[model samples]
Target chain A: MSHVNGLPKKSPDMNGNVTITDCGDSALVAKAVGLDAEAAWRLVHALADALDAVRLTGGHDVVPTYDALLVEFDCTSTDHATVRSVLAHEAARLGPHPEPITPPRHFVVPVVYGGEYGPDLPEVAAQLGLSEGEVVELHSGSDLTVRCLGAPAGAPMTDGPPFPKPVPRLASPRTRVDPGSVAAAGRQAVICPMPSPGGWPLLGRTPVRILDLHSDPITAYQPGDTFRFRPITPQQWDEYADLSLADLVDSAGLANSADLVDHHG
Target chain B: MADTLTIRTAGIVTVQDLGRVGRSRYGLPANGAADQHSARVANVLCGNDERAPLLEITALDFACVPSSDILIAVTGAPADVTVEGGVRPQWEPVPVRAGETVKVSGIRQGLRVYLAVLGSFEADRLQGSCAPDTILGFGPALSTGDELVLRTACPPLDHPFSRIPLFRLKAPVPPFPTSWTIDVTDGPDRAEFGDTGRRLFDAPFTVTPRSNHIGLRLQGEVPRRVTKGEVLSRGVPIGAVEVPAGDELLVLHRGRGVTAGYPVLAVVTATGLSALGQVRPGQTISFRHRTLDQAVAAHRAQRNAIDALRSRVRTAFDALRIRAPAGT
Candidate 1:
């Protein structure tokens, strides 16, 4: 992923109960700092609690900033002034962020690159002036972490190394992208959970159904969960195709190869 | 028995009360009526709690046979209602005889209709909600031959509105005017767009065929980049209007993906969100900008109106002296 310059600190003159930062467009962002994860959680929970206490009816939302919590309330039930007031007070009460959100955990999403599974693999490789296998190596060899799930909830954003040349998104999104299609846009790697229209450059696909709406936990990634990638050949994909859902579940264990490095198990 | 509205034909219907709460952590969409205001109004007319269980009908006919005579109200888009093949009224509460068939024709204007039985339907509430998010396999949509059980006996009206007979008097909920002129407020990422993007707020866009509960894909001048770089994908509220491809405007709705990567320009006000629900593919839409104060005022006004209606119903019910039917 292209490294962000990091959050620009608010200028002294702009300080207020809620100093708005010009993030872009006509809208402005309200920024606050939490000392640690607990503090962050408290800031998040307090605002949520207040929103709930007001009986504002809407779904709860979450995002991936370590030091901050993102809240969206029904504009009809509450205004930005009140919401900002509640959040800033809550954040100030909690303090600043701790170092241990630990830069998210890494995961190696095993993918079968090229052929029919990856419609854009050849195109991306050609653009990079590298062979398809080289493209796979470049992608799978790098370290990655779950940033946030976008578009589809549970669709994880994992960082990848810089492309040999930038791969642009499809000019026109396919009406339905196959589930498990490994796609890249900018420096982010995404695994499609369900068939959806997407612009990312498709590289390969995984056999794993990573998202289960009915699953108790729902999403596998936490803010700190890490991610890595491993390449599987198309033949391996074919072999797994005959397997039942149970067989696929069994295969997840076997897919863990000796090449895997464990910073933490 | 309480009041049972038997299904003759279920019409794309579902048993919805207030939606499941405290469950977004599990990735559940707060599935309920797209227009919560109308749903609450229907409930109030039927002498039920504002968020009581009701039938959410989508684009088709729904016929129900009431088990016990009770008051009922229909709200949302105006639809042709017939009882025993005779036209019925909208808005004001009316009594239906036991076993009488109530039929609502396919939406002539709006997409959904709310049917509140005097007493709500009884279902095992999952996480304090009867509204089902089918993605989670919570339950199936209401279909023909599905028997719904009402939990309490109907409270008899000493003088039912059926006399003044609010029948045939349909409250015309103005149909979504001209392809839905949705109101929006600037969001955190609105700054990501370039100056040209600011000009986009001045015009209207047409809804593309790709639009759905997930999002409204609008065809227009995609906003220019403000960040000149990428921003991390993050949590977005329903009705968050994002322009991802940099050409088309994507206005998220109730069923939008739980998260998103694209830059969001603004979020639509809650009062306008129901209008989004009625927006069909190929419809035209315009963006109206409002300050945060305007949004908050609109929100509070809607909430206050809903709460006011609720209290008024309570007062009316309290004065009626309707006894609990039989064995408690």
Candidate 2:
């Protein structure tokens, strides 16, 4: 990458595996830039700024999308072909992606399996021909990556250890899933943040409320943060009923209090 | 400080400005005037900035007494407005005498109305905005018998009667046929839908009764998700149309979720957004796709017209010879 006015210039190598995606009307997104979420994030912000400059100079209304910079032009003011040319030119000269930023903390979520909390536990266990305990062992043993946040703030989007048959959700979704329920959809896993309608196969519940709306940092997990799950008994889940979901996630053991150290704290 | 308005009956009123902007990142929806265009015009008529805080009255029956005489304007949804039992226009300025009661009663057509006072009103700003989001329980919605003190300068003119410039245009009614067109853009998940789903977007879809601030439950061709790529939850602004379960579309409005999990089908343009804003339950809506360039132009053009009309009103008001009484 070369520098123009001390700013990093976009290089041809940026095209490989790093494809730009459009999020909304005003956003352009650079995705799949390896696992460096921060690098892609910086590039997105810079491209947004560059596109904003172009809009201002051209007297157009352009906005940055979630992943892509949406370039809006006034048809009455300028031709579409001309605007496309300018976008192409900017995309070519834009700076390379920035260095990745590591998350401040990693969280290990512990979930209780079977019984009332996980209604689908028997079905999943029977399908796999494994005891409920073995299923929980497999689930809690794997390292789950933090894909992204969802509905409730800081709620994790996890690639699952794959349950048998990936049980189809309820014909009709439950009006409200109890917060802390560990749910599975297809091959993915999700920790419910608040009481919301969901159709996922719930394995068990955790005690953590990962999303704190009132707090300065709304969510605990950002992209690139690592997560692991551990199995806790339904009795253990009830023991720490009053404790938060953040407090129950453990790297090891049913309730390793030391592992529950608050990262924000 | 100017004299305040004594809310003899608050009647579901809340203080509003042009909802809190630049705070969407914090997961807070900007809960401002429901009818923003009407609110802007009302503020401009009273020589206040368009962003000034005002009383947004829902379903009327709100009455207030000005502590000191001052100028005020009301807009949005037709309501029977009067000061001391005298009738006044729904969308213009009127003078109120100090200690005299001003009342707005019965929503005739619209759902929400804006009441603006000169030099703004006395309100506690939360999260850099006086607008209240009832969903979050941040600010209190005005109830009956609530008194509001105005933190404004200058009492009413000695004469106490000011002629407000009248530029009357009837607010657009919904279920518009033939001429009414709502502009939408290609959705992020547009390609995910089959021909039938695509045709539904190309055709008109009826807005179902299940629509609200949360989202619009549309009755249209169901969109099929062919490829099952995991859609990451991300920020979805007002006017995003998503198809989650089937062919029916869920269109988001002003009080939309800051983030969503569904694949977006279309993003409505500003003009299309205006129609969506006024859409009540059971209204039929059709999507007209426009190029991104056209959407931006339409927004700018609409603003220009509104601004021009405001200037004309200001000029007419300035031309009128309403002089203050001689001071001793």
Candidate 3:
């Protein structure tokens, strides 16, 4: 990691680096290279926070991937040099643990475990030497940070529980994992909001709709948001059939209540 | 009475526009039309705003009849456009009488064609875009017998023979080429393929028939990885030239997801993407190296040409006292 202008940065930004690259003429990326998952996540969020604090005309998105921050803009209105310069300025200002774009929200996602919902549940449990109940208990009891949200859009990528051993990826990935599939690999967990090809072991399926393309901010679980998976029996699945991630987030009972104001949470 | 266009013979059709913006953070691709250049030209020629939804016709016969007389534009590809057996030219807006079927068939030289009615065509919209997610088969997939209601009953021109000379003065785009030369810049994972890296530019690639809106699969000299490592799944831009394990070089199109783990050796320029969008199956493409600045300049040139046309049309509309259709 290279220091920005040789200035000392506190905590997350300390020893963290960002290498900005141009993807064609339309998109720009600020990648955090040679960092672990947690460190990369922090550095990316910091950069994102710094950039989002200001208003940029012609900018389309500030998408946070697992280890990179992608900023897309309308090239007709802005040039790559202008956008890259702004990115560098914003990145240089990320001195420490930066804030989030919006106040962090919490959600309790209800999921149904095993059998048809999770074909790999039995194999995963056997490999981990934990019973199905124990696996569910350990996974549902842990709190996870929404590390990133991307791929097919609005899919929440978060942290899984500390298992005795890291879960291995599937030998052959599924051609299409249906939406709302709760999957886990190593210490990471992901909720598929859209049907996509995935290698992570499917632990369960959630009834709640995590992404609605028609709505802005498609998913409630942005980076820095907190969520906990609560296991449910198959019989109670229909109870949350029509619920969405927003429905639960709006009821988070935060200080601002329903308003998505910045509360530094 | 609702102005409608009833499909007589439908091919693979979908509604497209300039595409959705400010939705990528949610993983939504900037999917509007596969060939934005043609789509914009079609919309602007018919005096519709650039964002107005139009039909993107692929590889089959497509015919529709408007409930009322309206002006329409056909652009992209070298498809034959005919109105009630009379041949009409592409690129320039032409007046179509009510009940006369406008048919686009015999598309031999290209992959896609854009059809824009003068008024707004009602289609399923998601996040303010009519462009469907072709990968997931989500959104409106137009088919035979489907009647698309035009929200605004646009007043037709005097007659087909009374075509506006100003719009007609614009010539049709040149015929699609059998061979394409695309410009590309080095990608993030360009170093992955060592010796074979140069093969990407040196050899020619053929666009395979298995291609779709998501990506164009190509058959060419496979750039086998010299050293293999798990490439981190990072956010990718459109026009990425990915090397999959199966030896097929995949050039991602507009419908691809925002993030991917595949090794991207090069990224096609904006102008290259537009050209690739029109490439028919079995057509050859040769990649040429370009600096980032050159790529941007080329794209800007292409966009500037369209912008100039847009302004000219705006002035033409003012002179003709034409108003945009409703529900734009």
> Model 3: runs farther than 4 Å from truth?
A1-16, A33-39, A49-55, A122-138, A163-171, A247-265, B134-138, B151-167, B171-175, B226-232, B311-327
Measured with C-alpha atoms, the lDDT of residue A245 in candidate 2 is 44
Q: How well is each residue in B1-328 modelled by candidate 3, as lDDT tens digits?
A: 7879999988888778878776766677878788888887888787788889899998888999998877888998888899898888888877787899999999877889999988768777777677887544566677899998886655666454654333643633644778888889887667788888999987899989888777899998888778755555567788889887676898988887777767778888877888888888888999999987788787777777777776777776667776756446
Cα lDDT tens digits for candidate 1, A1-265 = 1112222333211222224332211112433342333344333434444444544333244333322234544444334444444444443444443223233333546688877888898888887898988888888876665444455535665655557655666778787788778888765677776676677888888886666554445565643355566787776776555432222322333344222223322
Consecutive 10-residue window with the lowest summed lDDT within model 2 chain B: B319-328
**Candidate 2 structure quality by residue, lDDT tens digits, A1-265:** 1222232222212443245443333433343345344344445445545656654333233322234333433333443344444444455566455333342344667677778888878877776687888778767876665544444433566666656645455566676678888877655677877666677778888876666545544565554355677677766766666655455344443344234223211
- In terms of lDDT, which candidate is strongest? 3
TM-score of each: 0.77, 0.72, 0.86
Candidate 3 structure lDDT:
0.76
What 10-residue stretch in candidate 1 chain B is worst by lDDT? B319-328
- For residue B61, model 3's alpha carbon misses the true position, in angstroms, by 0.8
What's the DockQ for every one of the candidates?
0.22, 0.18, 0.45
Lowest lDDT 10-residue stretch of candidate 1 chain A: A9-18
Measured as a fraction from 0 to 1, the native contacts recovered by model 2 come to 0.10
DockQ, Cα level, model 1: 0.22
